[model samples]
Target: MKRGEAILVPLGAMIAGLLVFGLFCAALGLNPLAVYASIYKAGFGSWYSWQNTLVRASPLLLCGLCTAIPARAGMIVIGNEGAVVAGGLGAATVGLATLSLPPVLSLTIMALSAMVCGGIWIAFGAALQHYRGVSAVISGLLLNYLAVALMNQLIEGPLRDPSSFNSPASYPLTPDHRLAYFAGTHIHHGLIFGAVACVLAWFLIDRTTFGFAMKIAGGNVRAARLAGLPVGRLVVIAGFLGGACAGLAGMIEVAAVHGRANESLNAGYGYSGILVAFLARQNPLVIVLVSLLTGGLLASGGVLQREHDLPDATIAVLQGILFLFILLSDTLYGRLPFFRSRTPEPKPHAIAA
Candidate 1:
C-alpha cells in the first residue's frame, strides 16, 4: 500500500465515524456540535485536562502493544485484559513480599514478576495455537475470563488486605514504593515508561532482523516455513512481548494510580487498547498518537455525562462505530485507483521496427 493511502484511509474512516456519531447524538436530542465542543474542552482545553488524558494514555500505550506486537506475527490474541490482571496480581504479590527491601529493588522485582506472569499468560495461548491447534483468539478470550476469575478469588480470599473491606483489594504498596509523578505535574512516570516502550517496540519491530522474520512469517506462513524460519518460536515470542507490555501497564496501574490490585485494575483500558491498536494499524509508533486520541475520548466521558446528560457508554458507542468504519475501510486498500501505482506502457514495437 502507498504511504499516502496508509495514512489517509484511516483518517477518512475516522471522519466518517465522527459523522455517524454526530447523527446518533442528534437523534438523542443533543446538539452534535456542542457535544464535540464539550469533548474537546474536557479532554484538551487546559493543562489539567491534558494531564488527565496523558495519565490515561499511559496504560493505553502499553496495552495497545499487547495486540500490536503479536499482530506482526499474524496472531489475533485478544487477551490483554487477562494478561493485565495476571500482571497486577504478580506485581502485588511481589510488592507485598519485598516491603522490607529497598524501594528500587522491590519495584524492579515487582516489574519483572509482572512481566513474567503476563508473558506466560499470553504465551500459553500462543503455544496452544501452535501445538494444540486451538485458535489464539478463542484461547485468549477464554483466558481473559479465567484471569479475571483468578484475580477475584485471590483478592477476595488469600491476598485480601484486612483494611480493604468494601473494595476487596490486595495490600497496598508503601508510599516510597509507589511511582513518583513528573516534577510539578499530576502525570506519573508511567507516561515516560509508556512512551519509551512504544519507541523501543517500534525499533524492535521495524529495525531488527527478528522483526523482519516475523513480518515474513505473518505475510506468508507456508513460505516462511519453506525458507527455514522458526515460525512457532516467533509466534510465541511475539505473544510474550505483547503480553509483557500489558503486564507492565498493569503494574503501573497498581503502583502509580490505584496503589493496590483491585477491581479497578480492569478499567476497560485493555479493550480500549485493542481499538487503539486497530486504529493505528498495529504500528508501535502510531500507537502513541492513537493512544492519546483514545485517552482523550475516555477522559471526556465524565464531562459528557455531566454537561450533556449522556450516558457513560456514549464513548463506547462512538468507539464501536469507529471500529466498524475502520473495518470497512480495510476493503478499500489496493482497490482505490488513487493509491495504485502507475505503470508506464511500452511504446508500440512497430514504431521501433
Candidate 2:
C-alpha cells in the first residue's frame, strides 16, 4: 500500500457508511432526509441546544484521546472507564479535603489530584503490558470493570454522604467547589481543557520524537525492537498517558457536571470513546471533530423521541449502525484501491528494542 491509496479507502468508506445509515433510517418508517433535518434543527437550530451538545462533547473529546494516544503504540487500552472514575474520585477527595483552603489552592489541589489519580490508575495496566507482555486490550478492559467495582465500593462505603437518605452517592462538593461555566455559556471549564489536551496530543503524536517512535513500534513491534528503540517504555508510556487523559475527563465530569461522584458518572462515555477513536483513525485532531458529530446524535435523540413519535431507542439504533461501520474501517482500508495505494510499502526503519 502507498500514501495515495491509504487516503481513498477511508473516503470510500465514509460514503458507504452514509448510505448504510440512510437505509437504516428509511426502513424504520423515518425519512432519512427529515431525520437529518430534525437532527440539524434539534442540535444546531438553537444556541442553547448547541451549547448543550458542546457540553456533552467535552468529555467525549477527552475520552477519544484516551483511545487515540495509545493506539499509536499498538496498544488497545479500553480501560478509560477506570481512569475516569478514579480521576473523579480523586477530585472529589481533593475538594472535600481542602474545604477550608483558599479557593485557588483548593482548585489546584483538585486538578492535580484528578490528574495524578487518573495517571496512576492506568499505569498499572501499562506495567502489566510492559512486564508480562499481557494483551493491553484484555488487561485494560478487565481493569475497567475493576474500576467500576471500586467506584461502587467507595461511594457506598467510606465516601457515602450520610446526609443523603434518598440517593446513594459520594459526598457532594459545596457550591463554591464546583467548577463554574465559561463566561457566556453553560459549557464548563472542561471544554477548554479538552481542547487544550487535544492540541497537546496532536503535537505529541504528529510533531514529537516520541510520537514517531510509537508509530514505528505500532506499525511493527519486531522491526522497532530490531532498531533498538525502547519498545517497553514506549508502550507503557502510551497506555499511561492515554489513561491519564481519560481520568482528567472523569474529573471534569464530576467537578463540572455531577458536582458529586455518583453512578451517573458512568455515562458510557468510556465505551463511546472507543467509537470516536476508531472513526477518527485514532488521530487526536480528528477525534475532536468526531466527538462533536456523535454529541449531536446524543443531543438530538431526545428531540426525535418527543416530536417524531419515535422511540428513544432510535439513538441506540443509530449508534449501533455507526459502530458497525466504524469497526469495518480495517476492511475498508485494504479493499479500496485508492487507499490501498496510500498505505506505505514495507519500510526499512530501524527496529526498536
Best by lDDT: 1
Candidate 2 residue-wise lDDT, 111-133, digit = tens? 78887887777777877887887
Clash number for each model: 0, 23
Q: What does the lDDT read for residue 36 in candidate 2?
A: 76
**Please, what is the TM-score per model?**
0.96, 0.88
Model 1: per-residue Cα lDDT over 38-110, one tens digit each? 9898888999999999999999999999999999999987899999999989999999999999998998998
Candidate 1 stretches greater than 4 Å from native: 344-353
**Candidate 1 — worst ten consecutive residues by lDDT sum?**
338-347
Most TM-score-accurate candidate: 1
